[model samples]
Target: MRRSGPVRALLAASAAAAVSAGLVVAGGGAAQAAPAFRAPMPAHVVAPYYETYAGGSPAALAAQSHNTYLTLAFLQTPAAGSCTATWNGDATTPVSKSVYGKDIAALQARGGNAIPSFGGYAADTTGTDIADSCTDVSSIASVYEGLVTTYGVTRIDLDVEADSLSNTAGIDRRNKAVAQVESWAHRTHRNVQFSYTLPSTTTGLGATGVALLQNAVANHARVDVVNIMTFDYYDGASHEMATDTETAAAGLINQLAALYPSEKPSHLWSRVGVTDMPGIDDFGPAETFTTADAATVEHWAAAKGINTLSFWALQRDNGSCVGTAGAGACSGVAQSDWYFSHTFEAFTHSKWTWGKGRSPWSEPKPAPRQAERGSRM
Candidate 1:
């Protein structure tokens, strides 16, 4: 169930993590161990998305092999305002593949946890995003709440990109839906959190993305994370892909710190996340998230206390497939399978604990601040 507000819900989640392991909760899957409450605290998270095989069984990439949490990708609501979660497209009919209800159950049963990501670049042929198809925002939120309740998940990731980003009206609709989902979580005594997945520029969130965050803040949506899709910068080879990503992240962190002026720098960064395509992006050969660049991005996240680190898809985590914008099968790199994930996973381990304020990789803890303000509830 939900709480009074984001602060109460977040605090409750953190407390749940402290409880013994066998404690179970019910939501989008079978009754299972509640997904740990690990936000607002330091976590070495290497969460990646699953797309190529998202509609099929999830055993191919082995989500647990290198990531602490895997992101179930593109839980799109179909066109014509159906609001039913589907994979990567606009279809009048339902996709036969079992998704949130079954696939999620299977993964969690195997000791894996994931956050459902809504929307993606694969919007409909006309550039309409999944979130935009719905005129009834509350209905959209109801679907999201149903997933959280069924899976016992800790969070819902709104991957707002493509046409949706520019749709200011749609952004407001999304913000309202998210706020309602958080409210439902409060009422249900479930601790479901929220995050936004937006595209970024080298310097940070663009005006559109910033507006999305602003709208959420204005709507009182408790966004626990602001995940930046850090690839696809088409600036004519002007900036190194990885370094530009850091620049983008640094800017976003500063923007967030300014927005929630009370939040500590470290805490603000902890709410920031980065996810780049593993290799070439859809923008042709403009840039590629090369294998070597993986360390730079993940290490930067570690040193800066970035909360979540993710790549595009698990299917592309291999080195065998090269060239082409990362669609599926491989990341178009020159390394072995799971190389990027393995490197990014390096940031995660038992060294850091929740609410510790800092990771071993980060500089020694800053003067203690109001830990409650860390969540900026």
Candidate 2:
């Protein structure tokens, strides 16, 4: 669904404010202006998953100005000296020696944050299945504490999406898992951030899904964000296929906002949101990076008062666009292109400004072309 006219007007106004002070590139030759003050979204954090092999590389992490990288979880047995499985089925090793140190150091050196995640999509290859046994709390806590002390990471994301949420036992187990983690984070003197990645609301997963998540967030005081997995809705239904993914995302945000108020005396509304890995399939038959679609999603988020805006990934759609025909340089590099273009365009064309009184990263303004020598003389 397209953004309502009023919402579009708001976006336009925001863009204009951002541009006047040179928060974004106005054109190729325009001179850079002094920075302006703009309030940033309180929790505008991006959580890119850094593969273990991809660890120790600051180049990619530095380019994005990302706030956090939710490193893939470590699965290990409960035994004291048991080996741990990294996300990619790589050889098991101690958290201190291998992945944790390497990943955190690289990201931190680049001024980015890293958080260790516990559970992922894969089944329990790690002999100790925390999901199966709530009693493994101490072992889970031990790993979490060790990572924090070793890597100096303050955040921890728990990706708890499992195969079933239909039964009470399942939901209870999920709740306990969160409680255990929060308890450990408190004891460690580390301000840990907790979150869950669940399917979007459209799926027939029902209130059980919502209940389990809401309970987890409420009971576990330290939980900070709940990232809704809003993409991959390929259910063979026309409505599901044809629905404007952004609008659907907006509605979900609104629902969560209402459920968790910003002014609540206790928590930060644990900002409700949706994330998608933008791709040809995301656009369906249109097969393109729909600027209008992206705008609509942003507008919906702003209008509904959602606290954060995140995508499933950054690398996927950085600088590419697909059209009715197929994918190519229909525009530019998908993910990177959109990030730079939209980020600048939003400043030039909308109201949001950079948080640090400067653009996240600066590009040099083009030099003026030389005047025609003969004609001028």
- Number of the top candidate by lDDT? 1
lDDT of 1 by residue, 1-377 (tens): 00011111112232233222222222222433333232222355667776522333333344324444678765665554565665554353133323334444444554555677777666522334546877778777876765654555666788776667788877898899888867655544445667788888888998888888889889988788889878777666644678878999999988898788988777787788888887877665667877778888877777886778887776566655466564555656677757888888777753434444343223223233222221211
TM for every model, in the order presented, reads 0.77, 0.59
lDDT of all predictions, in order shown? 0.63, 0.41
Off by over 4 Å in 2: 1-42, 51-61, 64-85, 124-129, 133-135, 162-174, 203-205, 214-222, 237-270, 281-292, 299-307, 319-377
Tens-digit lDDT track for model 2 on 195-283?
55556645322365567666665655434555565544555444332144454555555555554655342123225444544444443
Q: Give residue 252's lDDT in candidate 1 (0 to 100).
A: 96
Model 1 lDDT-worst window of ten: 1-10
